[model samples]
Target: MLLLLASLAFVQYVRTSSSDQNPYLMTDYSRLHPVKVERVLQGEAEAQLIGLVKDAKAKGLKLSIAGQRHSQGGHTYYKDAVVVDMTSYNQVLSVDPEAKRIVVQAGATWEDVQKAVNPYGLSVKTMQSLNVFTIGGSISINAHGRDIRNGSLIKSVESFRLLTAGGDIIQVSRTENAELFPLALGGYGLFGIILDVTLILTEDEVYRESTVLMNLEEYSDYFQNEVLPNPDIRLHIARISVAEDSYFKEAFSKNYTVDRSLKLSDHNKLKSNDNWVAPGKLLFNINRSTDWGKNAQWNLQKHFFVEQSDKIVSRNNAMRAASAFMEYSQPGANDLLQEYFIPLPQFDAFVQRLGAIVKEEDMNLLNITIRYVNKDDEAVLSYAKQDMLALVCLFHAPLSKAGQQRMKQGVERIINEVIASEGSYYLPYIAYPTLEQFRNVYPGYEYFFAKKKDYDPDELFMNYFYEQYGG
Candidate 1:
């Protein structure tokens, strides 16, 4: 055991040593595509941003929006374009406890929102599992999370200001500028730069966490018959085992049930930092390396969550889940995410085929998380066409050209199964799916791109995502 541990440690060290250190070139989380940018400007003031847009147009250069650059695809940047960094533009504008709403700048993260509203006993209605993502990025992607009641992130947004290609700031909402509402929400920053957002908030409550172990076949039924029917259960997420022995067979669900007996104040103090990141990263690297590590990770996760059953936590604290442990900066290899939204009825069949494909391709799948999203067709390129179960998958792959080709082929195969299951995949990840596959899954591509041309005829706002599929 000691020798095995030493060997893994040495391998991790070697991988870490080759980390990317070039400052001139830019890349997103995936680190697969690195390219040079004309310049990166800080988004400090609205006037400055508008001036920047005008300048880019005058120079006949493209503009790309960037937040934390978490989107794995090339959505946040384009080669030789001016990258507008929005992280420094974050600011909490207003919070109304009576109205259950908050207004914030586009660059503000969920963490910023949580800290501002925790005192008022209010929480975000819908967001991604982690609080580190920026509001602009989340809304651009129309993200969803463990909470099942509020639908997708777009449902929580009341209104937002968008800086269009013509240097005009316009208010977009369901009732105002209605035409642009659907087009801009999941438009991948092609429509305009989201300035600030007014979001609907919900009351923060204490809940008791519970875990249930079951087989893969039983999850969909259990969720429909048991979870959805219960009002007290607010947030729920499940996971399927990826270990060799229990691969895609064993599953477990973690449900957060309202616990009125517990005091919200007792648990509402926000966590400032992620704990045990070093050890967690070490163990996760092991999980990425060997089959033995996979089995060990599965067992450890089962024991950890099961042991914490009945633990009390506040909504804000729960949403602020630990993410530091997932960070990987290895040079030649990296972890990437791909999510597929399968209609509830087809969940079983999809998982069965998914397991078969992964095994056949010998893919290095690290994790698979299951979350629910209600039917939402409001966005132009909506992924949740119906009440669906999302499979959030994580995989580790090499960054070499040949390696990427192999990964792309495997990913395309999985997307084929997703299409056959009458499902759609998330667009924020890599563009491994062929353009034809993208059109098959999102039939509204024609209208979406046509609107882009209508709004920004010069194609002022551009990125790799548009360059790839906007044809």
Candidate 2:
């Protein structure tokens, strides 16, 4: 009882101390590169956005698009640029249950879409595991998650309206403005402002959660022989232990299998609030602080998931995974995410090398979640060149310059291993990997930047991502 009270007090202290005071400076979830911006404007009416773009172009000012600003990299804002906050423009434009499709403003979050379509027995086909991110940001990064059957987020996008640097809102998809379809979807906001998106929806399903604990080396075979071939399994995710004892040697797979015998209505209630955030945050902070905490977290997770085995949940409910527990707000330190996509054939080999590097560099890795991404080359900047397993890793990093430099060096070493194993690192995180490494992983980058020039010749759309690698 005393321990619980102490944890709650610490949570309150962290919350009260983490508040931001500078209104003129902008940074992302990483809190690493705070820069002064000309002004931040809330995206409202379409006409206002058009005018903003026109005025920026005329004034020779660059514009950056922002949505929740969860991207660890400076993909959302730049120095002295006008940052358009898109969350306000969020609205579910339309939903066609019969057609299994939905159109929404770019600023609309996955939560908004789920809420709007839940009544009609619909859910998003693919998105990040958490539903807090905006549709624009998800597509901008071309995110993917637990659902192994649907492929990456781009595969589910039907179309979207782009507000170009030239102040024109044009429809882009497989047919209309077809040339821009691939370029803009995963184009990382360099192409233009994504005004609204049309997405393909899937029917909400009832799933029975199941978990299997296995050695890390057994995961590749288990997934191929067991998980992939099983048609009943709709969504899957796995976690590799980061504790001092097991480290990356231990893993457990969580599968949500179709339960046709269960009624969807019984499990379809959406998880609207994180009722246990305070305790969850406290536990996670403990997990972040020490080796003992890490071991405890790993064991607790195994017990928790095993206990919840056979739990029934709706597809929409499962998509709304608990993320509030992972939120961190320390003043000098923050949690950051980096992902590496490895071809299935090399998963074991790559993980071995990754574990070795992390140990040698002494990186403060908190967690590693594995998810499958089907071969997708539809997006020009797509990460999944072949059927791959994505290692979504979270690390607690310090904001100091020396700390950042050390983190960069360690990350670059990991990227080296990734590239050697025919893998690719995700671009939405910090720009830690060298440009050479990025080009080696993403060979199409040259053409991608060229297309950016072709579309926005004035270079009106700007962010640190382009500044770092677009050259």
Whose TM-score is greatest here?
2
lDDT of all predictions: 0.91, 0.90
21, model 2: CA deviation in Å?
A: 7.2
Best by lDDT: 1
The CA lDDT at 195 in model 2 is 92
TM-score of 2: 0.97
340-404, model 2: which lDDT tens digit per residue? 99999899999999999988988899999999999997988889999999999999987789989
Cα lDDT tens digits, model 1, 165-284, are 999999999999998898889888999899999999999999999999899889989999999999999999999999988999999999999999888888888875476565666778
Residue range with the least summed lDDT across 10 consecutive positions in model 1 = 1-10
